[model samples]
Target: MSLAFSERARAEIDRLLARYPTRGAATLPVLRVAEREFGGIDDDVMVLVADTLDLSPAQVRGVFSFYTHLRRPGWGKYVLQVCATLSCALRGCEGLADHLEARLGIRAGQTTPDRRFTLLKVECLARCGESPVLQVNDDMYVNVTPAKADAILESLP
Candidate 1:
């Protein structure tokens, strides 16, 4: 019944647990470890994480499903989350999104056939002043235009 979490992940969980007073307080970090180890918090990972934290799988699932940073199955290597919040929307985020769809040949919430990218239309990325922002993996690009977005995509290795 082991989730086969790697030793590194176990060590990270232990470190994370030490910083929190209760296992429940460490839930997010634990799930993050699981996500890194398993590539996504699928059903099995949820059960195993619950077992490790002495919580129910349903509880783990609730938390896991709530966060967008957590990867789900089929998420591409590069996850491009375009901000669709009010600030970005007012600054032509919709048009940028449309441009992305046309350029990538895939709509939002879908991955390219090559599995290189997944375009997601997400809410605010907390960069309101820098409207029309999108995050590719850990990097955020602000004030992006269609041409700039295309150049960004082309620059990804």
Candidate 2:
């Protein structure tokens, strides 16, 4: 069976399609809707998105893979994406990634077994000055040391 969007997502897709001249132009927005509605963009959602946009699965997959914000399975309740770029790396973000992996008991790019956290080492987070930055889902935590990271993780419910 083909995957389907929820009513809310359908409405949003309709609005997006109206804004763009072609259905393909709405692919990214539609993908975001699917991600929000389904929690992540898995294989099934990729097919659905391709069908919705009148594009091939390869096309949708290409776009999906290009953006780090769009996630796949193994996503946890909180996704911690740390900057691995030069600025953050020079500021000791690698140690931060290691610290989180040890503390969460999952290596980078893996989700905790309990489904509570996922640690990912990403390229830039756009706050080079705030090196050692990581984004927990949409909210960014800048200047994160190991202690501060632990405290932040502990504070999450």
lDDT of each: 0.90, 0.89
Where model 2 places Cα greater than 4 Å from the true spot, the runs are none
Residues 1-157, candidate 2: write the lDDT tens digits. 5579888788889999999998998888899899888878898999998988899999999999877888786688899999999999999999999899888888899988888888899988899998899899888999999999999988998
15 Cα displacement, candidate 2 (Å) = 1.0
Worst window of 10 by summed lDDT in candidate 1: 64-73
After superposition on all C-alphas, the RMSD of every candidate to the true structure, in Å, is 1.6, 1.5
Q: Candidate 1 lDDT (Cα, whole model)?
A: 0.90
**In model 1, which regions exceed 4 Å deviation?**
none
Top of the candidates by TM-score: 2
